[model samples]
Target: MNLSLFILLSLFGTILSALIAFISAKGQGHRAVMILLALSTGVGALSSALFLLSGQTQLIVLQSAWLFGTPFVFTTLSALFFFLLNTVACLASVYAIKYVEQYAEIYNVRILDALMAIFVFGMQGVLLSGTPFGFLFFWEVMSLSSFFLVMADKEAASVRSALFYLIMTHLGAGAILAGFMILSGESNFESFTRLAVLAQNLPPATLFGVFLLFLFGFGSKAGLVPFHVWLPEAHPQAPSHISALMSGVMLKMALYGFLVMVFGVLPAAGTTASLIVIALGLLSALYGVIYAVLERDVKRVLAFSSIENMGIIFTMVGVAMFTQAQGLSDFSHVAIGAALLFAVAHAFFKSGLFLGAGVMVHAAHSRSLEVMGGIAKRMPAFSGAMLVLALSAAALPPFSAFMAEWVFIQNIVSNLATMQPLVQGVLVLVLAMMALVGGLALFAMVKFFGIGFLAEPRSEHVAHAHAPELTISLPIYLLAACSVAIGLCAPWILKTMHFAELTNTVQWHTDFALTNTTLNPFALFALLLVVFGLVFIARRASSNIQNERSYHTWDCGQPITSGMEYTATAFSAPIRFFSHMITRTKKQVIATPVLATNKWIASRTFSLGLRQIWYDGLYVPIQNTCLWISTQVRKIQNGVIQFYIALIFIALVVTLTIAL
Candidate 1:
């Protein structure tokens, strides 16, 4: 009946289904287990929404000495995050029905199903945990389980990506653990409820340190810049539904953690900390977008764009914090509330878009956008879903993403009027960066749609590939529908999202009514429909009036080849070239022409590969250093048992002498 009970039941259901799935390791056991798991998640989402919207202080507390602290507490925020978690889990569960068929051929379906259940449960624990300690325990559980999931493929690249993800996430967890410990020290208390007291007692420096720690820890998870290296590798390597969950919900879990820890717990965080956050956010937004615009790997492009969005959300939060510190609680609430709404909107559209991309990839047998075209005609459902998703992602008018971005930018502009001169200068940069990222995002989305869906097929494989299964397309459609609904009815939805309470900005009015102009998203949608209808009619009329003939795609009467078509790499080439100073694209061309009797008969080909900043910048040097270090350390692991015993005895003697 209560939210806590609902969450526990959902987790329990996963565990039960996992066991059943394991027991019935043959036949249709995986499907059955997945169905039950999906049902539990659906129930969890529904109940969580009920709990959060109920607006009652439904505290589910229990004192436990399992760790160094007492753990217990659940409020509206935890409920909100759990709702998101379960919703995504349910969608992903259904998707796995067909998505995991590729894996089932290699691994036991039952084992994978069991792991999937455990993975969802671990995420629930992370979201539902009341105390920092409880949160950490579940965080590790989530990370470890996810690590195993990433390594499920065990291909060389899979192994590498999984290893990178594991190391980075655990490193992030360590920082989070340290942050919690520091906050715990300041509190001199073990309970999350007592965090407010610690916030009041701790000095500014300690608060700032804790903030940075949490930033690195959770920012890594959220795939914020500098800490975002693991995401591009991890997301692309994981299975599709897993990628959807990771990008959509798991990243948001970290974001929820950051917000809960900072805004919920640290009541004393002020201007300086907020400014630092905003500055970092601006950099992330700029950097993420620039790289995203240049990426040819479709999933990687999406992944980088996520960094851009997260940066925008963080910037909004920073503005909210800054405004709150300046005693403008009304503006602060408006800003932070808008950011939270954006987070939700982003989750809906991004998940749907990624899943849609997954469907396309499966159908086309390629992740390269260059190879795909005319898919909108081939797979209408998937293409339409992707179109809506891409539009939303571009922050087009009336879409939920647009509404959120508008609210955020409006809040920033409003604050510029009253901010200090120095703060005003930074606000300019933030607003400008947001604008720039939005434009780049538009370009990127256009590229995705134009190259991958609308034009004629660029390759034989894509021309011949069929539509994705209904199972894949259906979930994406549902999510895209939610995006449209939310966009069309934003004001009504914002009424329920009480941002004022979250930021402790009680002075802000919860009734966010717009003045000066009517903002009707429904009107915008209708207008778009009409405009498109007229265009379609005109095109139809022209086809009847004019010569309507199809021919080879203006190839100058030369025989066409896949290379002659616009490749994804070539499409992004202009941006890549422009941003070469930043993106550092490395190009290699191998031109070996086919020859007949010592005369060149055919022109050679050109191949392109993008440079990884991390590889040349960090990984290669670290790898080489480690190799060199290993060579030195190899002397110690000599194949002699007697020598090893002697070395251990010598170390023991050294320890004894040191103790003496």
Candidate 2:
């Protein structure tokens, strides 16, 4: 079947959907917009991509005119990315049906709906664009749309964030264009297929420069460390469903570009390149999770955690590259396959978690976890959906996150003893870091769920909160359930990807392929079910509602106070103490001594701030340098007539001399 026709139809449908959403009455169009978005972007695009991947119908999708000098193109790989982009977009559209209502009073919800639809279309445009101009054009469409979404609230902070995002994103775009230029050489408009051929003949130094350009270009968008200053600042500024879409679907655009560059457009990069990528990923993962642990803002915490997850996926890709360079296709396939699966898992759970955070923040009217508690008691169903998302983020068993991490670790562990010394040592470090990052992620989520949900109400807002309407909660449950379903379907996914064939001339098993360790999700599910059943039964038997009991929880039975329970800050005290230097945590002293004689004895006060290594150590210095240079340059425009005449005369003489 000719998939191009279907894809074209989907794009047409997306435009129509966006147009309708933009024109509809302010409060009457959100539902229709979402329905149209789900059909066009969600169903239309998804069906076309999946049909192409299924390979049953002859794919006229891949043809000669489809490749060389075309505005758009497709392959099995792009088709896979196309599938992922639409999957999350579909669910997110449905979720936005209710999430945007809170903004309807203060903003034009119809325009917001249209922008979101266009944003998805732009992202799809990035995947489809085969030419450099096409790609950059679509990239800006996506970026500009998101910038407006970030500023939709019209807050000063959000405007600053939007400008910062716009500036940084354009810088990266420039770098990408430069890399494209270098690869295409004399033929600036060469298609990617031709560029791959051209790259094979390039000098080693030139190729290395191209790689650096690409790393910065793509890494900034992917939120890799040292280039990730904008990510946390920008992601939380958007509406929550918009945040979900940005975090879940948009980041993968960078991944797609990076992969195509490394393995597709360019020839084999050496071992050093692979190692550099690995280090970058490791640093980002550690940095992101540490901040996630210490951060108190609900959305900001999720933003940092997104950095961590992105870092982990980058590391897996680096591992794949290293193995591929070393001529070990077995480990390479496993690493790459694991990376893709991990990304899929992250998209589902992170989107759900962001949407869930929106719900909590909407009810409490605050983003601070310090002010949120007892959410579970107030909105049990909402809490339940979020719980699944939290567990998935923590990488617990019988969920997508666990299975993704599991297969990577299992493959490495089972094969570690058989590898060479160098490979073995690197694997050991990677394995250890993954374990540590996983634990920290779990800690972050526990703090996220427990401090934000389970405890007694920390403020008045939470005390009388109610669950949101069905429009909001239903999408969350569905997304959260995917976290479980994807995990259960891991065996089949891996098999379909031919991970079994690539990793096993040794004939690896279905669960823990090519590994001796075999703990399947099915087994884990069985174990957790038994434990859950027993706990439920015990709670049922222990209850005695007939004999009602109540106790004073705060102020010696007088009243409840925010200070009565374990606050999020206090919960993270041990971590702060241990990693204060890394986190830039600080304390202050407040003197209130009894008298002049005892004035030396003073109480200490704390005011924690994150002086992140990247933002301060790198971006700030660059900013100051630029400002200093600008001042120096400004001196030239002194606005004097005599000086201008002399300068013009000198310039005319110099030009005549040069021309002669």
Candidate 3:
């Protein structure tokens, strides 16, 4: 009934959902379990988060002596992530009722549902926890739960992907633990409040080391570059609905951690730290979009795009840090607000797109883009919803993403006049980098939509595709609709957060709809709505009036075929061609002449795509070094009791000598 009850219900009810899923596996099935999970999350968690975000900040610190004597405390920022996690997870449960049904025969749906429920519970715990001990405890719960989900398919590839994810995540956890230890200092204070107080007195170098540790640790979770290798692999291997949770909701947990450390615990970043964060963010944005443009898998495209969006969020974070350090408190709040807004927008749009991807993959029986086509004509309503999500992903007009980016860009541009020349130059370069990132992001979304959904059916599987059930369909459209609502109501949302002390610029708006406002998103939304309505009516009327079928007269008796449509490889060929040095594209061609006399006639096969540059250049060498070390260590583990005894005796003698 109350916010505290809701939070408690959200936490325990999640565990109840998992228990129900496990116990009633044979009797109730996934639908019932999913509904319980959804109600637990949507009604309780969602309400609490929404109420908190609406400016009713509640403080709940419950004792957890049984675990580690730490308490559960909910901050405004935690409430923000609570809203995001539950919102996406709620919709995902509905979608999962259908999507997981398809995989029921292949994998244990009950186990999957249980794991998913635990996964959500773990994330909720992370958001609710007050200290690093509780945070890492629940963090492992989340990671381990997802690791099992990734390997649910029980295929060799899935297992390998899961192991890779496990290794990377553990390394990240280690880094986070180290950062926490540094912050806590000698007294071993586990509370974040105490840690922050202690951290303020630490030396500059030590604090900066903690900052770097937090970045690497959280960046790994957020799917940033160099630490992003696990994301694409693990997302594709997991069930599609789970992929939505991972990309849309789970990644934001990392953002939550990073924000907690940088804005809450650690002091303001220096120039060097700010520049490093900004550079990494920019590099991640560019690199991710490039791969998104190059990839052919549906989920992989979304995964890479998630990297790009997270990059944008982190860049805003860097901007906030830089502004705070420079004594521009107002602008710092504005930049961080932009980051927060983008995170919210991404939570909806990216989840919607991933669920939409699941629908496509389910209908077509493939994740490969090359095999899917003509979905726009069959599932036109679904396609329309997906178009909204795709546009949001591209940061196009009249979508929440565009508004978020506009604020970030506007903040930078507004300050260019007042800043020093060096600072102005840096901001200018950031703008340019973001512009390029935006363009490539648009290109990637176009390829994702056009090649996968618009053309003639590229394969037999897609040709017979049908629409999904209402359970599967409704949640995605709701998410898509949020993009428009978020865009139109941007000013009000920002104003509310500003009032709650989560954002800035409550003073800029007299009314969002009024003409005097710097940006009237409502006006833009109305304009687009009218244009789209008119076009839709015209198309409907034309279709209704024309009884006779029209044919292409230029066909010359040769019927249209899928062979005429562009392949995924061909569509992205230009990017590979132009960015060869970066992409390191490899090509091979084999040809045979029809006849020796007919030199001009030949049948040829060709292949081209991005080489695994990061894998080969970075990870592979590291893997090799580890393997070499493992071999050297293996020599000491010989199967001889006498040698082992001698080694133990030598170790005991060394211990005694050191004690003396």
Candidate 4:
């Protein structure tokens, strides 16, 4: 099959799915439409996977014109991302079939379905596009579609979040456009191929400027720190399945743009620009995980964790850029491969985690971890799936994330030996940061799972929680299975991805061996499985030998209460204590008098608040300045037509004098 025809078929399927969803909005066939949408997305996913794995590297021009061309470039990099977008889209659609039912009463079901299809379509377009015009067009489509989805709840909070997302995303798009126009010049060559050829002749200063523009532009969308305020706000406000897609796949679109601009368009800026990227990535990794540890909202914790993972990905990209600049092409490829592998791994586990969060939220009627406990007993299937995803997020072995992170660490360790002492010292610091991020990630996930799924119920809502239907559970199960399978078979999967073929600087003795080090994930996974089996059998035998007994948990000297159980806040209290300077935590306690005669206190209330340092320190000042400037400008608005005419005449005279 021709690659262009294959891509066109996938596009058609997505568009048709959107049309069907739009028409089905006014009818009672929403479930049926969603299933159809899932099937359509499945077809698209299959097609993309086939195209990517087929080892085809030809550029397929779907349409061409004088000003711009619509071409699909099938590089190893683009193909990998295309596969990521389509795979996540398919699974998210399936998950939403039942997940969106709860929102049907609160939102327009048809609009939700239609927007989802359009979002996937726009993401695919961004990955497949070979021209700046097409890229920006699809980029806006993706952003707008997601914005509407974030606003699906029609609440004041969702509206505010949507507006923030809209403003930040467009700001990024504007920066990207400015960089592209500067590069296009009078020739107006819109194609990336042409831009790449022209980039070689650009001066160093111009290339560096373009690099800065792209870093800020793409970094905003990628949820890099400082520009990342919208992410935690928007992801939690959006519907859960949409949250899954946004965090799982949509964030990678910005990565796609970075890869195109930095590696494809302006390779000359690699050495200088990479240091800045590494710094930003380190900050994001540490800052994001710190917040995740303190977050009490289940979805908000996942949102912050997404930022941490994005930081890890950006770090891998920086490693790639830095090694390539230093003329170590093999090490560069290893870093790039690690980034790609981690991306695929993240999409699977993170989507599953978000869907599991949806299950918890729907069952408990709250996103607050403080309100949930002992949910594993009520929703075993969902909790089990959540446990798998949580372990993967913690970078445990026999999970996809562990494999990726191991490869990343291996790349860093391999390169440290050959670099200068200063560079080696910097790498050591990066390694420590990565380790710190991992430890904090584990701490956060344990809090999430333990507080939300274990011990006594914290609230009446959680006590009545139940498992979701098969429709929702099925997707979570599939994603969990994929995470484990991908990790266990990573060597073969990497080989099938033509991972080695993506670079030519070095040759490997085997699929899993990088230079001297060999990774047998399957062997490690099997050993863990055997150990788990032995423990399970031993527990079962011990239980059979002894008589079963049940009793209430012992309290020290009084009756036990749910309050005695560890709360999410208490779990993170130590972290807050140590990091108070950065987290800016505030606590308040107020006592009320019950009896006027004795002036005795009846009850006390304790409150805790966490401030966003960037939002408070940076955006607030800018926002206030803008408001003041707007107020001053309003003073010039007068009702009198004569005053306006006089002002215009003076402005015209000034313009004429400057022109002369």
Backbone clashes under 3 angstroms, per model: 0, 0, 0, 0
Candidate 1 ranges beyond 4 A from true positions: 1-4, 61-73, 186-189, 499-509, 513-517, 534-564, 587-607, 618-660
For residues 1-660, write the lDDT of model 1, one tens digit per residue: 556566667777977877887789473687788789999999888977877677664466444665565344556666777777888788888888887785576556766777778878778877667667678877887887778777666678877898999988998999988877777774544556567566667787888888888889998898877788888888877777877888888888888888878877776467888887887787778777877777767788788888888888888888878877877677777777677778888888888878877777776777777677778878776788888899999999879899887776766665578778866887787778888889989988988888788767776777776776677677888899888987887877677644324435343355443221266778888999999999999988777645566665677778666555566667777787778776775667565657766645666666566676765788679879989999999988889999999999999999999999
Task: Rank the models by lDDT, top first.
Answer: 3, 4, 2, 1
Candidate 3 vs candidate 4: the TM-score winner is 4
User: Looking at model 1, which ten-residue stretch has the lowest summed lDDT?
Assistant: 508-517
Taking the tens digit of each residue's C-alpha lDDT, what string does model 4 give over 1-660? Answer: 666676677778788878887876363666776676677667667766776668665446366562255675566567777777777777777788778877678878888888988999899889878789888989999999999999998999999999999999999999999888878776674688677777778888888888888998999999999899999999999988899999999999999789778766775446668888888998998899999999999999999999999999998888778767777666777777778788898999998899889988887789999989989988887888889999999999979998888877876776688887756876788899999999999999999999999998888888887778788888899889989988887777666666423223233223333323566888888898899999999999878555777778878779887898999999999999899899997679888878766667467899887899999999999999999999999888968899899999999999999999
Q: Which candidate is the best by lDDT?
A: 3
TM-score, each model?
Answer: 0.89, 0.90, 0.92, 0.93
Q: Which regions of candidate 4 are displaced past 4 Å?
A: 25-27, 59-61, 64-68, 499-516, 542-546, 556-558, 586-606, 654-660
Candidate 3: worst-modelled 10 consecutive residues by lDDT: 506-515
Residue range 122-171, candidate 2, lDDT tens digits = 98888888777678788989999998988888889999999999988999
- Which pairs in model 1 have colliding backbones? none
Select the stronger candidate by lDDT from 1 and 3: 3
